[model samples]
Target chain A: MMRNKALAAPFVLWAMIFIVVPLVMIVWYGVTIEEPIPYTEIVQPDGSVIYQLEDGSRTTEKPWQKRAVFSLNNFRRMLEPTYLRLLLRSLKVAVITTAICLLLGYPVALILTGRDFKRPALWLLLLILPMWMNFLLRTYSWMSILENSGILNSWIARLREAIPALDEWLLSMGVRRRIIFLYNENAVILGMVYNYLSFMIMPIYTVIEKIDKSLLEAAADLGASPVKSFLRVTLPYSLPGVLEGITMVFVPAVTTFVISQLMGGGKVPLIGDIIQNQFGKSSDWHFGATLSLLVMVVVLAFMGALGRIDKDDEPHKEVRIL
Target chain B: MNWKKNLRKAYIGLIMAFLYAPIVMLILYSFNNSKSRAQWGGFTLRWYHELFTDEAIMGALGTTLSIGFLAAAISTVLGTFGAIALFQMKRRPRQAMLSVVNLPMLNSEVVTGVSLMLLFAMAHIQLGYVTLLLSHVAFCVPYVVLSVMPKLRQLDPNLAEAAQDLGATPMQGFLRVILPDIMPGVFSGFVMALTMSIDDFVVSFFTTGSGVSNLSITIYTMAKRGISPKINALSTLIFACVFILLIGVNLQDLRRDPRKGKVEKVRIPY
Candidate 1:
């Protein structure tokens, strides 16, 4: 037993140093403010400069001196209306993306696991193959297809040229021949759904696949309709997968900077973009840390709610899929 | 009933098209001669030729492969051993350890990326290949642990004791009895680690510096300036390689258990 514990020591130490400490550092930086050097004029030759402190204490300090202090200023800044709106928009986009994925992915998963479907593994492999490509490159490919003068519109233009009446109707409806699809919130959502739909499908497919066929046979034997069997048995059983899929999609969707940057073109900046900017171009580590902490708290709360749903279903068994 | 089946097939086809349109465009544009994505001047193999000769891209690809290989190999050993030790622990302590292991898997990539960046900065470590590799290993360990734990649970606990009773040493028991049983899980863990390491962008972006970049980073930086057709060519080659590799792995698995090919479930952790 003693030797076994010793064997795990290195990994435990690594986790503590890398995982635990970095989290603590985020919280610490989030709450603490770096004291800026006070502006003061040198009126005397005694090496003293006057500056006002937070407590309104007038002090004469040595030139170029600064002190760190605890403050809620970063949190206050995070609550500003601009930041709040960005957070809200991010939530909205993430929710829409998750909903769309569930609608599209659930049916696909059901069909893939159906009795009539052949070569399910090959189809699943096809679904997962695109993920192996560089994600940025994948998102960038969408640009060529959706850009105003890109493939889709050019195809539309060719069709319109063949049908003069349809072109005239479109022009009369105040629609431009070239539809600008990129650099908007809709484009960002489309990009996200394209990237994350696979995640939603895989979990639901696994859960539905794991459902014992005998249970459904028994339901049919009991004279229950197919829809009734589905609702009573399949739907309830797949709640865990649904919750898992939601977490998988919502978490990344809300926090991803890459999709929004590539698709939004800096116009529809989300909270993630702001957080990334603070670290990259803005160079405000403290504020960035605060935003990260905020995101972490919200994510934890979201997971906690989903976990409660899971526990309600299977109270005794500890179900951890991920 | 026939129409219902046709409807299902058509729905599957539509969704598959949605999933594959961007990928299809990437492959098609690789053969396009024009530098502009919007135009198709002619069919040309110029970009494919350039891809082989581009030094920066070749260097980035080298870094990505080496880091992925090293991270996966190191994390698999550590995580396998860690899973073994953890299996011996009491229930409460084991759960606690497992949760800690899962932290990296659950946390947002951006947070994990920035936090590691901050850690490296605080420690005064140069942010380059070493830092990037360390962070990759750190994140990849949790996946390995998760993958291996399920297999460990499926194992027979008394097998090791049975070996010991036959005068076999602990090391001998582990190598001869335990290792063979857990080979599938270990293999899946290694594959998962390698895939995660290679596909990673956000964490790698934050933790790397001194001009050391991976394929994802190179793509992202180039994307800002409108990605060249050479990238399209490179992506096509990569897709072909992965397609072949997937076919090879599936064929090997089918050879092992021909009847299970259609119904085999990939044992992903989540």
Candidate 2:
């Protein structure tokens, strides 16, 4: 057994390099700013200023020699209104998405686990099948449906054409010919709910399905009403699952850029969109890392709180993966 | 009472509709003859033909598959051995090690992607296939370890010792007895890793460069610029493949053991 412990050495080393060091690199990039080294400008007889570099090399208008130094400048920049708004928007969207998934999913779980269903597995498979499709393609599908002149609006147009009275009523009610559905915060949230609904449903369903039927029977024997029995017995037992479901949905929903990009049509920018921008259009890795750290902190804090609440519960029956 | 039961069925039906509406829409438009996305455009197989002929899309599909297979295979070996080693350790260290393993999973995908991008940048490793592959394996090993750990905990510790006590050496005992018991967990872990690698987009986006991309990246760039019926065609084919693959895997499981297959199918990680 002692000798067997050596098998972990290779993975530990790999983890240190890939998993641990990369995170440290984020911190290294996050809190630092690049500043030009002090240089003396020397004017030559020809009127071309030969810049004296930090290393004492003379050059004709050489680009500023910038070096990375520890600073909280990025942190301060993160506190600015633009970034703060993005963070708030991300949280707002993530919270609403999670809430909607729970409200929509809990009942679905309950129904699936109910005694009437002879084959819940088949139905559950249908629920999860959409996830196996490519993520981008799924969002693109929503784009087709929710675009300004897309399927929903086209159907509305056809309806108004068939019924002129309905058209007059809508016109009198101050409704436009085409209602804008995409490119808004609501659209981003809709896309998120569509994608992550399964994460919420799966865990809650697992927990509810595992409840001992005898417990519900005992509650009934004591003359508890159906709702009362569910509130007391089923709800408490499934709390861990609910927490797990929240963690799973909330984490991805908060950190997502693609759903927002496609669904929001680049109009509604979340913190994720901004972080992705830093790496792409912005080209400021320092700022990107700073934003990444903020997201990391928020996610860790959320999971840590959930962990504390769930500490006394039994370990989760299965490990979750995307 | 009948109305109440009807209400439950109605609710489930509505949720299923919400879930599958997008997919059905994609499938519908994939065969549209006209290039415009909004119009009905008579049904034809033009986009499907285009989908098969497009070099960039096919190249991305190739890269996605090769990387997914390699990453899954490498992570399974490393993770299986790591789980075994962790199983042998004292409880305190094991718990600490497990938390470190969990970091990549628990952290935001954007953060994980960005951090890997930074790591590659700092280390002078070019952001391409190698970096992308490494990042996938990094995120994947944790899932593999987690899936295998539960199985290891359930195994009888003395079985290996008993086999050794007979005539077998330690390695032989492990190969003959312990390996067979834990093979299911390892296989599921491999499947999980494969799906994860294939499905990953956010991490791959940040950690890849130099004209190398996977299917998700290709779809994203194409969608961002404008809608394309070819994408619809590609997605339709991919969706069909996924549906068939899942059904095939499930069917094989059912043939092996009806009761266990149902449970295992339900146990598949999200």
Candidate 3:
């Protein structure tokens, strides 16, 4: 074992250089801001200002240079109301998505794990196959369904034409000819749930599928009803999986830019979108790093809390995306 | 009781419809003759033809596959050795190492992406294929290690020692005895790493330089401008490939043991 322990040295080194250093780099970028170097402005005799540099070199032009110096400017900016609102909006969306996924996904997992259910593998595969497709494509496909003039709207329009009285009744109730389903906060949540539903189902299914049947029988023998047995036995056993599912769905939901981008149509920008903007259009890596540090801390805090609750569960056996 | 069964069936059907509606819409619209997404002018295969001929899409596909392979290969080797080493270490050190390995997988992709981007910027390494591949490997190695670990745990620790007792050198013992047992895990890990690399968007989006993009990035940029039927066409093709690959892998496992391999990759991580 001692001799074989040397085998991991290369991987350890790789992890340190890649995994550890990049995080340290984030912190480095997070805590720092570019400040213009202080200079002594000397009024030149020729009606021009000369700048005295830090090293006492005189230049005819004003010194407008900035250096990356340690400052909490980015952190302070992060605390601004605009950024705080974005953070709150992102969390709100993520929480909604997680709740929706749990509500929708738990039953799917329960049904598939039922003893009466045949070929659960095939069913699970059917559930996960869509995820195997390109994630961007999957999100993009929703546009066709939910867009104002998209399929759903078109179908509703046709139905309204076919039933004129019903259409007039709907018009009286203030229903638009074409529903604006896409490009909003709810649309973004829909995208998240559609994409991440399997992530919720898979873990819950895995844990519930492994729950001992005898425990249910024992509960029944104790005069517990089916729902009572589920509450007393199955629910308690599935807590770890539920937590895992929530983490899986919530973290990605919170951190997602793509779903928000495509579904929200830039109308509903999450913290992820803002962070991406800082890197892309904004070109504020320092600010982006600050936002990223905030996201990382929030996500880590969440996972750490979940990890504590499910500490008795084997951490290694938590297979993500399976 | 009969109604209960019917209710379950109906529930499953409803969920399936919700899940498949978008996918079906994409597949249906791929063959659309009209350029507009709302109306179906007529059925045509023109989009698929354009999908193949489109230079940007083809180029991105090539880059994606090449990076997927290279990253998977590099990570599998690194992770295999890392897993073996971790298995041999004392509990405290092993736990520490495992948590470090989990960081990239557990961390938000945006954070991981930016952090790596910063690292590359600091190192003065130009972002392109190399940085993209490196980041993919970095994130992917953990999956490989996790996949292979259970296999290592299942292996009798003395098997390698027994091979040594039979006059085999440590490397030979490892190659013959330990490798065979862990091959399934290694293979699965390789496939896992490959799929992960291919499917990745966020990490590649940040790490890749201009004029170099994977399919996901290509699709993202194209999609942002508006919907293109060509993307729908490309989605159909990718979906077909994934479907076949997953079915083939699972079927192979089923053939090996009917009772086992019920799920695609229920690899029990140790």
CA lDDT of every candidate: 0.85, 0.86, 0.86
Instruction: For residues A1-322, write the lDDT of model 2, one tens digit per residue.
Output: 3255456688788888888999999999998988888788998898878888778887777666688999999999999998999899999999999999999999999998886566576678779989988878888888888888888898899999999999999999999889899989999999999999999999999999889999999999999999999999999999988998999999999989999988888888899999999999988999999999999999989988787322321233221110
Quality of candidate 2 docking, DockQ: 0.53
Error (Å) of candidate 3 at residue B94 is 2.0
Tens digit of lDDT per residue, candidate 2, span B1-270? 889999999999999999999899988888888878778879899988888788998899999999999999999998988887767666666667787788888898999999999999999999999999999999999899888988887777777777877877767876898878999889988989999999999999999999999988888888867767887787788789878877776666566765633443454555
Model 3, range B1-270, lDDT digits (tens) per residue?
989988988998999999999899889989989998878889999999888898888898999999999999999999988887777666667788888888887898999899999999999999999999999998889889888888876777677767877888777877899899999999989988998899999999899995899989988888867767887888898898877876776566666766644543433221
Q: RMSD of candidate 2 to the true fold?
A: 3.7
Model 1 RMSD, rounded to 1 decimal: 4.1
Which is superior by DockQ, 1 or 3? 3
Which residue segments of model 3 deviate by more than 4 Å?
A1-6, A39-65, A308-322, B248-270
Instruction: Report the C-alpha displacement of residue A103, candidate 3, in angstroms.
Output: 0.5
Tens-digit lDDT string for candidate 3 (A1-322): 2354356677788989899999999999999998899899898788888889989899987788888999999999999999999999999999999999999999999998885555686678778888877888888888878888888888899999999998999999999898899989999999999999999998998899889889999999999999999998999999989998998999999999999989999999999999999999989999999999999999989888787322321333221110
What TM-score would chain B receive for each of the candidates shown? 0.94, 0.92, 0.92
Q: Could you tell me which residue pairs clash in candidate 3?
A: none
